[model samples]
Target: MTRPLALLALLVPVFTAAQPVAEAPVALDGTHQVDLVSEVNGHPYRLYIAPPEGYAADDTTRYPVLYILDGRRTFPAAVTARAFQDIYDGLDEVILVGIGNGEQTFDAWFSHRWRDYTPSANAATDSVVAVQFSQDPETVVSGGGPDFLRVLREEILPLVDSAYRTTGDRGLTGQSLGGLFAAYVLFEAPGLFQRVGINSPSLWWSDGETFATEVAFAEAHAALPAHVFLSVGSEEGRSMVPPMERLAEALRSRGYDGLTMDAVVFADETHTSVVPAMMSRTLRVLYGRSE
Candidate 1:
């Protein structure tokens, strides 16, 4: 099995990534890009800005910015999967900014994502299922998510807001570890984003009781009102589904005065296949435009 296949194999209900699926291709239609170098708390980050298709200086229109994790892959794929041209054919536009690795992604995202997403890394005690990527397999530098988030807020978000015509209505997206981070941000900083799209989050990574974190957050923040979309591939890892359902129910009980939580299980999508599927839905749900 390929490395990706090996990763997905750990997940059950297996929609194998080995097979091909039909998806429409994207045409650039004159892409505009700007490479930016920025810093947050003294750490430097690289940013790639993909302006709206058919962009014009005189348009002067403010658009919703989509902040995508795993930008090395997701940014281009999402731009195409969402059928960029078709979605913005008539309606307003959006800015696609791909934030790449800062020094090291595995260390940066893995360690920090856990710290930011999970209520506590010490919460897990189970041994029946092993959560891959839970520990720093090599460097022993883990749990720095709060710092990563600071990079986004202080460095990335401000750059996009000032450099592009932004409406301040941002959408955050991630898959697996990234998904966990997205959900974490939602509960911890409810007002930071208007919408969040999470795909195949490793809910069971911390423990079977990750829902407790959300429940606790709701108890503390009475007015947490943000739209949330959660998805896990039916064929994903063994622990993906049950925890997803648990989280949905937790949100239901917590009550978000204006919260909209959607949990999706794609029967034919494994952990790997679900990325594109999630991106497709995320575009429609957040942007209000579908191809």
Candidate 2:
């Protein structure tokens, strides 16, 4: 499996040398792209969109939409994975939309994610908020998740749903803190997305406080109205995954209706190398045809 660019690497120097000297140009079999600007709550965001393979200006075939967080860093790989699975495994072709920081530079994009992906400092998620990118306080943005989701629900989703043929079946994919945000959405706005692929979620964030939120959600709702695909590297920090297991067990014990969920730990994958296979596997489980 190819390594997905770890934003943490871009922020921390110890992982700097792992990055390639030069970024290769992105090439794909069937893809389309558009750049968009969104101003929500005084914050401007950059959105990079890719409609499904063979999309037409006048076609009425509504397709599933996949919203990828950290678009600048993850879009190319997602486009390629979507196309490959759509063809080889007979998965449904999807509308791919990448949400990026308006800033095109890596440092800025990486930094901005900290602000957009983390939830606000509630008593629950504040105790363990450790800013890793302390060397540059500027790179460590946190607790702006609600505004970011608003941009998606109110701005980006409406734009695509209006312009393209869409089924309104939305799926979200993100890593680390982005994964944490996705998990938050599962409870906070369970109706917003139909499918979610949360890879290597930083459950360690805030000492995995989200686990309590999930349990509370399960108690409140009789059914979870989404398909969820969760994954983590087997070697990810020991504390990172046990919470996910407990979460899965809790959900399983509830027997919630309309919910099909699975969590897998890739045997040999690490945080930096899990995303490509993670996305590929996640798309298959979420949308691919079963044998």
Candidate 3:
């Protein structure tokens, strides 16, 4: 099925659902499940939005939102852990927004994530699962990092701002490959997000090139205005530490007057087991509440 070059041109469908359903909560905290849908350049998007523990309809209290990657799988656990923290800390009130595929999980998470997070399309990029899983060519979504951010800026952020009493201070988070992507976004769009929490980031991807770029950006720039929390499993892999260290060192060397960074190696956690604890700690660190 060799399609014509004209049809093969860049005319992505931008598969998107309508705005999320802010339905009445089954519980009083407005902690119900919601999904935000949007599109960029014809590519559809669906993000998970989890309201605060006691999301009162009439309280009119603005909350900080956490934009999570791989929401389909992580949302449930995050919700449970958040509930626990809310009880333990007695101050766990915030929104958890999980960003993932609407109906196409693979594309929403992997393909689209790679395109939007990585700074380069080079085949040598590491920490990325796209090259290992991508299948379709027409539906093959890639190399739209900036475009994806535009969708977040134009479509998603506006919807969040208008619908809820949001503080306009958002946090971005992810695990493994997703975590690496978070680092990419932090450097690429410094003004968009205020905090980023990356757990077990796949810095090994891209041949450790992201560090050099990040260093260059920090050196050339005047100031950084966001806080970064990067953690990794000590026993995960040997190749992960140096790059992570380099990222922190780069920030320090370049002088982060406004940046608050905490990079730790969790000795007892694995790549897959660090998300829950990291989420709790990251929430506390970024939002100023802890359990």
| Local distance difference test scores for all models | 0.68, 0.76, 0.70
Summarize candidate 2's per-residue lDDT along 124-210 as a digit string, tens digits: 333233343332554454678888888788888898888788886999988888888888888888879999987888776666778
Per lDDT, the best of the predicted structures is: 2
Question: What digit string (tens of lDDT, one per residue) describes model 1 on residues 162-281?
Answer: 777789788898888788778778876778998898778878655554567677876777776777888888888678887777787788786668888777888878888878788877
Alpha carbon RMSD to native, model 2? 10.4
TM-score of 1: 0.74
**Candidate 2 steric clashes:** 2
Best by TM-score: 2
The TM-score between candidate 2 and the true structure equals 0.82
Of 2 and 3, the candidate ahead on TM-score is 2
Candidate 3: what lDDT? 0.70
Q: Worst 10-residue stretch by lDDT in candidate 2?
A: 126-135
